[model samples]
Target: MLPLLVLVTLASIAALYVRGDLNPILCDGPCGPQYVTPPEGLATQSPDPDEAAAVGSGPIDGRELAAAVAGPLRSEALGGRTSLVAVDARDGKVLVDEGDGAQIPASTTKLLTAVAVLDAWGPDARFTTSVVRDGGRLVLVGGGDPYLTDAKSKGSSVERADLATLAAATAKKAGRGPVTLGYDVSLFEGPEVSPAWEDGYVGSVVAPVSPLWIDRGRVGAGRSTDPAADAARRFAELLRARGVEVTGEPTETRASGATIATVRSAPLSRIVEQFLADSDNEVAEVLLRQAALKAGQPGSFAGGAKVVSQVLSEAGVDTAGLVINDGSGLSRKNRISARTLAEAMAEVSSTPRLGSILSGLPVGGFSGTLENRYVRSGQARGLVRAKTGTLTGVHALSGLVTLSGGRPVAFALMSDDTKDVNPFVTQAALDRVVAAMADCACGA
Candidate 1:
């Protein structure tokens, strides 16, 4: 018990300090210091391949479930554009569709990003950032790891694929003194910001979509302007501190040679867990490109979007009305249907290779982006696992929930008309709707 308590504490501190998600605007104050009862049983093992089906495999009364959820969605705060869906995952039975069908998903779009990356790379894969030799120069290579931390960073294995680690090994191998440093950021291509994204989103909303970054692209209150360059420069500083001389500023390059030292990100499963729990925009963007590269496509906004669509098709998750202008869904041009979002949750719950996706969704009142949420939800606290989304007009929730009857259900609730409403009001309305589902005995 103490182990779990200590673990949760460390994770929370790291999240608060490191992820820089504490921005007053990005983190709704409701994502609390207000902790609730933790989950009944937090399983670390993999679920059965057919668990979603096994749990939800029964005659589902869709009408009963729909009737139960109707009143909550009627809340004026949600606006008229609300979209909702609840699917009995196993049988593909939808229990509700009580509002307009599709809307902007905001960070909930990370769900699609999660599915695409897991599908392409498999769960155990890790991203590697290496220090490689190029004649007298040492080139720091970015393998698209957004969690790569700089030296002197406080990190666990999952957080600190530290540049300091790479620097030590490089210095030892190079045998003393000076080396010109360059960075290879050719891994990702196209405009750093998606064409559909706002000009101001680059530093504030996310770091430039460079394959390399340190501290998850976080700078003071925002993100680094040139993440790749910033990372290279940080690496040089680490090397210099280690008594190795770095000649000149790190320059960009394409001619990287024999690897000097390599540091790897945590496996895809762990990476997926952190990014989803935190609603990390930077990690989502990088994963999009990584998946694109695996599929022989450009590792750019368009390419990642293309690969995401292809992988969803392969996983049998519907992508209808899914328009992805960028991997992170920061772009208002992105559009996804409630049906598609719910089905993606269903696939994550049901598929074997895709299993890690569910484990990563933030627990309703305990961790990640959800820490301050669900305070008003009764038994739903700590029981719900979902990815939350927030944009000016956009508010969304999508993931799995278990009914009072223990029937596991996949659901999505989304809206774009809430810009006129207080963000907290709309978010609370969505939570009430989900909490009602948790407490319902709809099968009877």
Candidate 2:
């Protein structure tokens, strides 16, 4: 005879399946900074130019690189100031060093967070969400799974750990009697919302940085004010649906219980891929916390920022005058020199364990944030893989590009004084600068 637990779990699955509750849906679809439609006939997985370019093909010609980038840098579209640093990724040879002072970096800050987290936990590391029972109460504890979902599998849209699966497993173990559900959100420290954030950020830009959230704490089209409570409540509803009597509303409390059911998110490599390729702010913030926890620090803004700098410094990336206020670079307070950003890129590019830190970045003009960009730089298309940064007056691109001679170089380009200039014109100029570099075959 089949065990009662196995029979109960099977029954729950059939019931949910019959109701079509397990249908695969697009949760993280191309909405809100994830719109990555392939450019016409070219698919995202098409053979890339970088793959064909041989590594270590250059002893870059400093004077040639300077001459190649000079005209584009002087464009009036760049406003009054620009900072640029380009270095060979293989041997760390400085090719062109233009502003060496710390400057504001926008979404490109995800690069630093990606590198730190990847170093702390290798590409195969995963986050787990589990449930436990103490007496008659059940507690749902979150361990910072960024891709935790309340729906069914998301296919390739994302790496998901669906709560429905957990619900099915839990229903088999718990008794059918009434029981209270509790949730623990003590994994992360205070200040759920950053003080430096703009007023409009919470609802649209991102939701609160909670360790426990479903669908990134979304309710319809808006963000949830209390993601953990909402998640716990959902768990209770699922348990009840499976014939397990849930008592009152789920409450917040420190939980100590025996294991009941658990689920784990995809590997950290896949997480970092989504982060860089799509510039996923939620994942970036969660990864920063993971980095902090690895350093034995509290999972909060301050602790994460401190660890980011320390990790980079210890990796031999120059962190002088680097001020990291947040992991997503959404804050205007974050500052780092272009040279520092370039060095960080080089460090990641050369390290074997952190290869995704570069490979996962969106291909310029082909995918990710750069899909609409580089329209005018055909020669540079599919050749450049870089993280883009943008704010009101700041536009930055820090990434890797291979030359016509097959030499790979990491570059950081920032222009913060573009308030008076048209954004398109500045971006075009930036693209042209990279195109010029790609055309330079002076490595011989």
What TM-score would every model get versus the actual structure? 0.85, 0.87
Model 2 C-alpha lDDT per residue in residues 7-27, reported as the tens digit of each score: 999999877544445533433
Q: Report the alpha-carbon TM-score of model 1 versus the true structure.
A: 0.85
Best by TM-score: 2
lDDT minimum window of 10 residues, candidate 2: 26-35
**Judged by lDDT against the true structure, how good is candidate 2?**
0.82
Model 2: residues with Cα > 4 Å off, grouped in runs: 1-58
lDDT: worst 10-residue window of model 1: 28-37
Give the backbone clash total of model 2.
Answer: 0
lDDT of 1: 0.80
Candidate 1 segments exceeding 4 Å error: 1-57, 152-157, 376-379
Residues 44-67, candidate 1: write the lDDT tens digits.
112344654454545667787777
